[model samples]
Target: MAGYGDDAGFQQWASENGYDVPSGTVAAARQRGSSYIDAVYGERFPGEPAGGIEQDRSWPRVNATDKWGNAIAVDAVPARVIHASYHAALQELQSLGSLEPVVVAAERVKREKVGPLETEYMDGVEGQDALAASTPLLAAVEGLLEPLLTPVGGFPAMMVV
Candidate 1:
């Protein structure tokens, strides 16, 4: 005669009677139950975007390619890494008080995206996670430039951006 009340009391009694619970099983069960309820009741998870918009269009479009002219996916990490790395390097250079050279270098690099040298670099680093690799590259650039940007001429104290 286990009604909901009896079921609840029985569960509590079993728990108090030294029933072993597996690690994380309660949390996992709760999550699965919650997701099932949401699915059935048509509730959205917090901050989940509504459907029908292209989510991957955040980055600027680029025609990635190999030296042999083979097309690469725009979502490919090596290409994205090179693109983000160049931009980050230019930002570092600008923070070091030379915006003009960085601009020129950026323009040059942009034009050289299809050149042999960039192709070689990309090929060597191909199949690696570009975003992960770019993190250390950015950190190293910041480390080298931070000391040179210390306050001067009544400027505010240097802060790592």
Candidate 2:
């Protein structure tokens, strides 16, 4: 398997967005995108192809959302589906509003975005939209993340050692 999308896919995304990013930068972005998707959706969505997600091979599913909380249409498939490391990035890139933020975040971490996406997250946002947007990693991943998250309120769990 070629393994989902790659630098080429990332570059295509950049070009379409009018950004002249390098292949390395694109690769980083794609890697980060893949890691992000895998972390959030792997347990629930579980991508096809085993190794990673194949945009073309990935089944089309409804109930997708964008960073702006807008409803992305699933009426028809496009001529080409942009596949990142995982389907999460693919879903974000498929969106109208998410592409810019993800690209921007990816560029910032250039050639090293993958690791950043894999780290622990969503600690104390408390379901605040403003707080989520302010966090770079969360902002880039909010579209896929927020939907999967459930809120827990109280004085926090306690354990005495």
Pairs of residues at least 3 apart in sequence or in different chains that clash in candidate 2: none
Residue 122's lDDT in candidate 1: 34
lDDT of 1 by residue, 1-161 (tens): 10111223323433674444343333333233222222211111112223214532222223534334555455432322222223332333334322112223233222244545553233213443333222222343234223322222222222223
List the pairs of residues colliding in candidate 1. none
- The top-ranked prediction according to TM-score is 2
State residue 116's C-alpha deviation in candidate 2, in Å.
38
- Expressed as tens digits, the lDDT of each residue in 10-111 for candidate 2 is 567667756566433444455555554444334443123322344433323345333345444454212122332433444344442342333243333213
Candidate 1 local Cα displacement, residue 74, angstroms: 2.7
Q: Name the lDDT value of residue 49 in candidate 2.
A: 31
- My TM-score estimates for the predictions, one after another, are 0.19, 0.34
